[model samples]
Target chain A: MAEILTAKKLAIKVSICLAVLVAVMALCAMVGTQKISLKKVFAGPGQEPGQNIDYEILVGVRLPRVILAALVGAALACSGVVLQAILRNPLADPYILGISSGAGLGVITAVISGITWKFWGGSPIAVFAFVGALATVWLVWCIGHLTGKSQVTSLLLAGVVINAFFSAVIMFLISIAKSEQLRSTVLWLMGNIIEKDPAVLGVSTVCILAGIIALFSISHRLNILTFGQEEAKGLGVDTAKTTAIAFGLAAFTTAIAVSLSGLIGFVGLIVPHGVRLVFGPDHRQLLPVSAIIGGAFLVVADTLARIIVAPAQLPVGVITAIAGGPFFLVLLAKYSRKVSWLK
Target chain B: MSGIIEVKDLNFGYTPQSTILKALSFEVIQGRFVGIAGPNGAGKTTLLNLLCGLLRSKAGSIKIDSVPIESYSARKLAKKVAVVRQEFVPVFDFCVAEVVSMARTPYLSTFGFESDTDKKIIDEALEMTDTARFASRPLANLSGGERQRVFIARALAQNTDILLLDEPTTFLDLKHQVGIYDLLKRMQLEKGKTIVVVTHDINLSTQYCDEILLLGADSSYQYGSAKDVFSPHKIEKVFGVRGFAGKIGTEKFFLPLGKFAKDAHIITTNINSTTKK
Candidate 1:
């Protein structure tokens, strides 16, 4: 009876959170660069409808940007939860294993070398970035495998080493790039979700949603994983198989998010960490809650990014870093003192 | 079948060069509280890992019931055998209820929530281990004894016939150690479940366990009733220490005469004689 009541209470709490998210999204939609009439925004074109200034800005510019922010935020935060569990590290995030740097390297090479191939309207750079992410993940796996079975420690170390190596390669690319190429690549690396192209956003939306669902589906197994590899195996989980699937999905979601929007930092790390701090770590609750809260957070941050400088927009990544960096330090200090398991 | 577990010349090693358990053959009958005792390097924990199929043996056969252990699926094997490790340090704050609920992993369908029956079983397990009151507390906040009980409850919630423990009482106070052993004995006798424990305290184990499996410095083992296995001569031979068998209040125990104490006495006598001269 008490268990059922607790389940009901959790449901109520989640519903309330989702309600707040909807209200915040609505508020963000209205308050962007300029206000849009809510009725006009919700009402579709019909017999009495005609193109207007508010309609064009709201539907054309802000809506797609807001949607992209939400999607990318959801993907990064979900990936953080999954990566943290599989890697068995509190500091793990979507980019922790050098996936982002590898993607950045791919994008830089594509832009600098003048590669021109467009499949389904996505820029060649986006496609190449995803490929690079997958390749780096494979390299990490190979290194982890060489030592023995894929121990978490070996995998984490391999990620750290590969991240350094990829960052160096990216730096070399930056050094040799033409001036114009350098400007464009730097903007992409700053991470923006204001993609005006609807076709690219459509494809990435599907990918991100599918990846989030996959992570959520396997979340129960991830809870078992937190107990450690041997314990997880003893509990009937095929630890190797579960960890592989989880890592693949995390990489998949993160790759898609990075390809869509350059490299938004800290949404992954802080959102999941914050969620765990509040909800306690049952991945069943941690995974989806983190995603929802992440979506809402990014929507708010992107809105602030647009209006904070009037006409000129700050990169959403800049805001997240400014906010998340100090917050993470405080969390780290608190965790070191209170969390016995981290040691 | 005379026993639930039958081993035929089982051999295991982490690497090819050194064998941890060599040509081991033993049978553990159903519903027996068996204690495995050895010195520091005797591979007691390794033996428990092998029994639970957490580690694969390179040679020989281990059969659970009539089927080879290797033939069972991980989930199937889990349903039949549950293990309580020495200690667990959780990376996240999981409540006692949540931790115990994880033992239902084998029975739960993929992505399935716990059924009412599963919750009932969990409640019953907590009750059995006297951990019901701590259900809402974080596992990390509990004392060592309390955490140990919670782990036992988790194993109980697994609903297996065989329960294996590896030094479950390590790092626990003497009172907590006795409490844990008492709990295991109660589980075995009252519930008729087969229990296997690994420990360094031969006397406590001998007093509580129905049978004893003694591992020596060399990769060998002896299995028999406690009386046969815990004899003074056997203790001295296997442990390389002098032990005298004695009785107190109709219960038999052994006292170790320390070899280090004799050496210290000789050194002290030499120093005193030289100073007096």
Candidate 2:
């Protein structure tokens, strides 16, 4: 709800969220199997870089993993927010657009076919996943456009059909895969955040940040869009243009997240919704706060995944589902009675 | 010829096989209140959509302020005309003021935030619609009529010269229905807006509108002042209901005599008690 929205209030809110994220990230970064002293991370006077075990584990290992999780989390969450608005459906999430399934198929193809391709620090799987996601989005867009019907409904139908088809293909590939290939395929499908490539991490950070900025710029248009396509048009929004752009950007960001960290679940669905409840439905407040909080949430989940099994790390996606499923149920039970806003 | 909204022989349909509006032509003069009434599937909403360019009139022309509707971009047309929907169930809990503030979309760019002047306009809209009291409350917390008023406020905030509404009084209680019409009348008399509403309440439309457009199921219509167009014969012909036409004060009203209206002395054309001095 609106409260005489001012730039100052939004700035203050985002700053508080950013501070919380920093605290959460710091706490999670220190929670791995090896206890890391902050002194080793920064290195006092005579200590050589990466010389200490604590330094190597904290700065070298935990830091990159934490950053990747944060990036993917933010990407998925903000994309979820945009998709929810554009689709005007509460159940809509980043994966509802079929980008994740598309990426999953790509990962399977790369794993089973054993054809490696690399570009700018991207592994074959990541590259394949990115391509698959984008291609699926393009196909969906084409189908939606070709139908020339209700944009939202067409997109949803296309996405669901494509996702179902791809999931079937993925299952088929998994059934016949060699043992090692099957292991890799299952691992990617479950989602992981283990990128040692600095270029990939840095590039992903820049892309995710840019995507979030783009979404923020369209936040006002998005607010109107949530009120159905015709109503948005009644308010003078170019519903077609806004939906296409928001859908594309959300898909792009989701694709990036999926490529970098396999098929992580629920952060997008849970984070935006929770943030909306607390911050109200204003996207100007919702987008940035959800991104920061979403990032922090996954970092914590990833941390728990790492420490729960000690040296044997669980895929971060497994942790998210194990955590997210119960949290989502709780949210439904508590808020189902209160959601009187819609018919 | 001085028409703010001029639709000439408009024809439309969701599909080519199922045409809804057929060769419809009418003009709403600027600064007047007009009502469009028809039975279900009579293309009343289609007409409104055509006027707003939400639906293209494949075989005809709709002009706003003497310019073709297609000549202006959506944003540009929205500056001259605003639309108020029956209800807004946006699936999110937007506050009254926030929902109203959304009317400022055409005025603001993608990169532009609402300025103080825009805020003042929103406040004024809320004030005009009498929704200012609950401006901070979640829209879901409000009653149906209150929610309708909030949408009216949103349209008012658009500050357009023309306001078009589709079944604006649907599902509202009698009081809120009258309240919405009163507000619309005020919008015409005070703000100098050209008003058009599609409504099922033919009696209320006759009371408030300067002119009435009675649409028939067979692509025919009657456009005249309420006294000229809203007769017992036309009402019965168009709506398939027996109508008793009478006057209360200066405004004409209709009474629909149903098949099972109940054998009560309550059914009266007794204009004496109901008529006001």
Candidate 3:
């Protein structure tokens, strides 16, 4: 009887996730200029020349944007789930440990120097962003290790300090940037899903997917981690090793996401919490559900960003922050009611 | 069913120079309900941490079933011994059943899903600890006593032969304290589980334990039957309390005593006379 209930619950959760994904996909296709009909959108991009008004737009623009949104969203959300579990802090987001700040700093540096193109004009921004993110994670870990206090509190404090430092550096770079360079940098920092090469999107999608898969594979261990470090060890987890792997995966996913879409915040913080409220904090359920919800959330947010200003196209990051900031404040207010030792 | 744990010349400390346990040695035979009693900073928790491999011992060895603990892999050690810590701050809001099921992690594959056998063990543990009723309730919502029982259920689900509890009754009320002790005693008798409980409640130790280990300062330890080790002299020497041992309804208890002033007798007599008049 209980097994039946468990099966039913699982099915309902999966069905809801699939339904959300489909709904978001539809919204993404329908929202942009030259709206495509659902029938034509799914009918395999009309083959007849010139009769395919919707085909070019669907295949050329909307599809890549939607796919990018899903990939970046999933990456951020999955990173958030792992960080929250490891740090045992519900307030922890993907950027809690300065990954986003580092990525931002790297991009600002690239823009201020008029180095828009990669070395030899190839993927410079993404490469710098990834490297910077990695460096930031490494620095935070080193400081945590040096303190000889590997507790979550110490790691969090280290991240906060590093984030502050990186934020200041980014501001400095912005101040020195030329007008055109500054405008471009501002657009990048505001974060958009515009003009991404399909190949770069595909590569980033694979990276983010791989990181999410690795994280989900350890869902059970993550469940144990929610019990805090000592109990996790007592339950036979190699706490130190598991902690490192979790943080590494989180950094990897966050770096790739930030590389793809410059510094999109709050999707990571919002989606996982939303999933947890529904799914009850079981990472086995929470990770997958958060991924789907996160993907859908970003797609819808991007759709709104495109439509809200009409033709001028506000940055997707601006839309998400506008949507998410109040929600985050509400959550903070709710969680602050009772001061929990674990948080 | 012969199971024995021996700690030989164990040395441990949080810092480099300040050793908490120095050359501390003892042996607990299988199925014994051993209570560890001591005053504050007596290294009771440190000793338990060493036993469970949470803290590495600087010197000596711990052996279970005549095999050295250091020789066993962490997973293997988890299968043999389970530690129930005094305070647990759960970061997520997991159901009681899910929390208890985590004990099967060591026995699980890399994926860590619970098998049918694992489910059976978890169910049995929940039943044993009487937490089955609230299995679906979030652990955060439960009362302190309930949470403690849930943790015990988790330890029980580990299916280990040795169970170490670090001050399990620290925050519990009197009823819950006695209740947990009774549960441990029952498990020891029925399952023949080796139970080592570190507690500041010497009275409970005297009433429930098969044996007691009194930890003193300067790396000294006294171990024997509860009666033999819980004497007033030993209590005073270790706890800096002038106390007397007394019996009330087949249970021994210790009460603090103090020297009398020269006018104490006269004052007592005057009070008695006044009451009589």
Candidate achieving higher DockQ, 2 or 3: 2
Classified by CAPRI criteria, candidate 2 counts as medium
Give per-residue CA lDDT, model 1, range B1-277, as digits (tens): 3227778898888889988788988888898989999777888888888888888899999988868989988888888889999786687878889999999888877655688898899999999889998788788888988999999999999988889998999889999999999999988888778898998887788789888999887887899988678776677678876644665664567666565765445433332232122
Better of 1 and 3 by DockQ: 1
Query: How do the residues A175-237 of candidate 1 rate in per-residue lDDT, one tens digit apiece?
Result: 988999998789889888765488788878888888887887788889989889888877888
Off-target runs (Cα >4 Å) in candidate 1 are A1-10, A46-50, A326-343, B1-3, B260-277
Better by DockQ, candidate 2 or 1 = 2
In model 3, what lDDT does residue A123 have? 53
Candidate 3 lDDT over residue span A70-170, tens digit each: 88888888899999999988889999998988888887777666654554336587778889899999899888777855668889999999999999998
TM-score for candidate 3? 0.92
B53 Cα displacement, candidate 2 (Å): 1.1
DockQ each candidate and list the results.
0.45, 0.53, 0.44
Tens digits of lDDT, candidate 2, A28-119: 88887677788766774335654677877776778888888888999999999999999888889899978988898888888888886666
- Residue B9 Cα positional deviation in candidate 1, in Å, after optimal superposition: 0.9
After superposition, candidate 2 runs with Cα above 4 Å error: A44-50, A116-122, A328-338, A341-343, B1-3, B17-19, B260-277
Ten residues in sequence with the least summed lDDT for candidate 3 chain B: B268-277
Query: Each model: TM-score of chain B?
Result: 0.91, 0.91, 0.90
Fnat of all models, as shown: 0.51, 0.58, 0.49
